[model samples]
Target: MTTTPEILRYAAFTDLPTGGNPAGVVLDASGLDDAAMQRIAAEVDFAETAFVTGRDGDAYALRYFSPIAEVPFCGHATVATAVALAERSATGALRFATPVGPIEIVTTRGADGITAAFTSVDTDLAEFDAPTLERTLDLLGLDAGALSSVLPPRLAFAGNWHPVLVVDDARAFDGFAFDPAEARAFMDEQGWPATITVLHPIASADAGGPRRFEARNVFPVGRIAEDPATGSAAAAVGGYLRAIGAVVPPALVVIEQGRHVGRPGELVVEIPPSGGITVSGRAVPIPDDVG
Candidate 1:
């Protein structure tokens, strides 16, 4: 029996080829098992990869895998897969049934070319205890004063849980760094799945635009040092913003990530008037035969 090549490349969240997070896209994953999916992701070595199977009406059942394991959902990979499909079949809307819940995507073609935006599952936010916050800071090698009291420490989840730690200033964010081993150890002790450390400066005050934020994600449990672009994290931040009442209803925000490691990606999040958050971005193909 001949095995089918099951992976494709997509650069998520940017129009420029080099500006977004790269994800492995598997358009059809009928026979692939958990082990095979994990192996393919590891071979691609991108932050995340998406596998689509089981069509249900307008929505398709989707699963996400990292190099080491499977995750509930991944935003950048979703964006990448949607755009990849749209580029070939013409731009339109696509729906996904993820481990978390249903996600929606709309693809379009404009003068700048093709693009896509993904809507995440329903979100929730909850505050963390003082001890948890203190321990997390210690793990990251950050001082207590470095955090923003205004933002507070909260566990936000769109599909998966992420603890959002807001920084006092962008300069403090610049100095932010952590030993992955130490950080992983601390997270294990806390019993949290995975944690993403984010630092954000309010976007320029000029246009009253949606707040702009920068983020860094650590997925030690997934055996990755950092993620270039994260959609789940973006939804978590949206939930955090809404929980604090910092953002008004019908909010749209832009998240800039992946710059530190050179693969920069963007995520645009839309907070609905009723509920749930939508994350949108672009995904471009990576040549299949490239070695």
Candidate 2:
């Protein structure tokens, strides 16, 4: 008898199928080894793929793989996979024991769709050492003069590390363009620090409960040129803002990404007074043929 894991496709962060970042989910990867998982991820060819290896009483062992290699964690894939599990079980919370640590996921069914919220591991924010920032700006063809002084560049980590760079407006974020080959070389030289999160704050016209932000992730990484929405990056941004004291406590930050790439999506990041950041989004199944 031959056994094969069922690969599920889901787009996270958007109710509509046309938007959001697509992720590959393997619900039961108990028997798949490292090589097999890598092969599956490459075959799926999304920015990232998630595999579930074991299910304990309350926690599932989770692993994430990019097309190039394995990563410690991924947020959008967690949201997508959590919604898939929530559909089959009662409404409540599910926990995943990732390589980084255990992350709690809560799911709900609503008129819009099945939404999953995942609390990231405690974030560690750091300043990029010296010339790393300068090198990054050069690679992107950006000047330090164009960046916003209020929100300076910093390195943030939840499950993975992403450099948070803030510009004055959408115009600065939209103007960023880079060569994939040169970018790849830079990443390799700089030790492959996930994706660089470039962001611009969208001011609220009215008094605030929710703050809006626009972001783009260096146009491309891995095999994909653009990710419609990035949950891990959003989490990192939340951590960065909190560390920099740029955002008020107990705030809801709404992030927009992938607009220029055409697959627009939104991510809701909730920053509590303290502890891990919570990132929430809906995941819709993508048909095999259509994907």
Using lDDT, give the best candidate's number: 2
Query: How many angstroms is residue 158 displaced in model 2 relative to the true structure, after the best TM-score fit?
Result: 1.2
Q: Provide the lDDT at 199 for model 1.
A: 61
Q: Write the per-residue lDDT of candidate 1 for residues 79-110, one digit (tens) a residue.
A: 88888788778888888888888888889888
- Per-residue CA lDDT of model 2 for 80-181, tens digit only, reads 999988877776789999998999999998987788999999888988886999999988888888789888889888888888888885666788788887
TM-score for candidate 2:
0.95
Model 2 spans > 4 angstroms off:
205-209, 219-222
Best by TM-score: 2
Off by over 4 Å in 1: 188-194, 204-207, 221-223, 288-291
